[model samples]
Target: MEDLLGSYIIFLILLFVETKGIPPVTLAIIILNMFIFLSPALGVGEVCLSVSTTLYGCEWQRLALAPLHHIDLDHLGFNMASLVWKGSRLERRIGSARFTFSICSFGLLTGLTYLLIKATLSFLLSDRFNLDCAVGFSGILFALKVINNGHSCDGNIPGPFHIKKRDACWAELVLIHLLSPRSSFVGHLAGILVGLAYVMGPLRMMINWITGKETSSVRFAECCQLSRNGHPDRDSDGDCQSTCLPRHRRQRRRC
Candidate 1:
């Protein structure tokens, strides 16, 4: 990951200097990436290649693990710096739990998208490099850029190049591929597509619906627990019909 992606790394490092409120889930992911990278037991062969049809068999679990492993300290640093930058914005805006769900879901989708892209390339054009393996958080970082930009498209993605928020992810993909000829081009492309898919609609709705349901379940469970203790959901207006969270502000601002 060099050139445009590398420039982003520098920009993100400078951008990440302000780490005021790095959320819990984001912190866990940064820690996990570091642990995975530093541990000799989890080397590249063990945690690499989310999917490579011509090489390793599809284990499925690797899809989640690959994003947590990086090739080197610089790679890890760039991604973690980015995680801190983007994760702070996203987790604060959407809350940690929902952010966690979004990461896992979009991460897997990005891996699968990589698989589909490789398969299509190999089948349609017989691209030999489709069998290669790639490992890093860059793919998911691209997706986070999508969500991040969608939430606040007030300006351009700052770096050496001036790119509007709406087109920044794609612009980075092409530029990185062009400038860093050895980079994981298809993998990066897959990430941008996954990001577009998310911002365009389906993924966002699914995450929101799932998290909302989980929150409601917890609220109900808390209400039941209180009832067992000779108390129940006591609303401000004396009507518990609104549930335990008072029906309005129990969740984060995203609520």
Candidate 2:
């Protein structure tokens, strides 16, 4: 860890590795993450450890920037590679619109989860985990993996261990924490919970109903027109055909 540049060499090599058929939103996230990593800010901001700065006030930006910032080049490279692999399956399965919504929603949701867990521990065990500042996309990556695993019928990660798909996220969570002892365990665990929330909890239904202005632009299986007055009108060839339906129901919008 002391040799940050040395750790970056492997990441540089991975830069040339080609991954085909990356979905558009996935690619955009990768580019945005990489750009932020290389920018003058280097993903540094009032985030990272801002969750529980003190009892009086919180930076709030941590909820937004933490997922996008990385501590090092190696971290950025590894996360981007994982996104390419995971996003290929997730974004393609659910359509870029829903996947995009999930990513944004999951990021904020996981941060709140992280804070709650930290606060709980701080109260009970005096762990003071909430004051801990952390950054990176790995937490959300874990969340995505949980959802991806849900879509698998056979539902097991194919490997020497034959880990059951249901438990794979927990296994990886432990493995990642062990390997990188410096990483925040609470942040990662929060992501796993968020994924579970999305899979079996109220998250999916909530996302389905909360109509953002961007909802009209999403690709549903069939385009439903929103009348100019802002209600769903009868199906017509009007350009207003738009937005998402429930999970596993919507197909890519042709219009």
Query: How many backbone clashes does every candidate have?
Result: 0, 2
Residue 196, candidate 1: Cα error in Å is: 1.5
Model 2, range 77-105, lDDT digits (tens) per residue? 78888888777667776678878888999
Which sections of candidate 1 miss by over 4 Å? 1-17, 50-56, 157-162, 213-255
lDDT, candidate 1, at 204:
62
lDDT tens string, model 1, 1-255? 356555754655565565654678987887677666656566677766633532347577778777887877777787788788778867776677877888898888888888777777777886664666788899988888776666552345557777776787788788877886767887788888888787676776677688773343222223322455666544432223334445335543322
lDDT of 1: 0.68
**C-alpha positional error of residue 227 in candidate 1 after TM-score superposition, expressed in Å:** 48
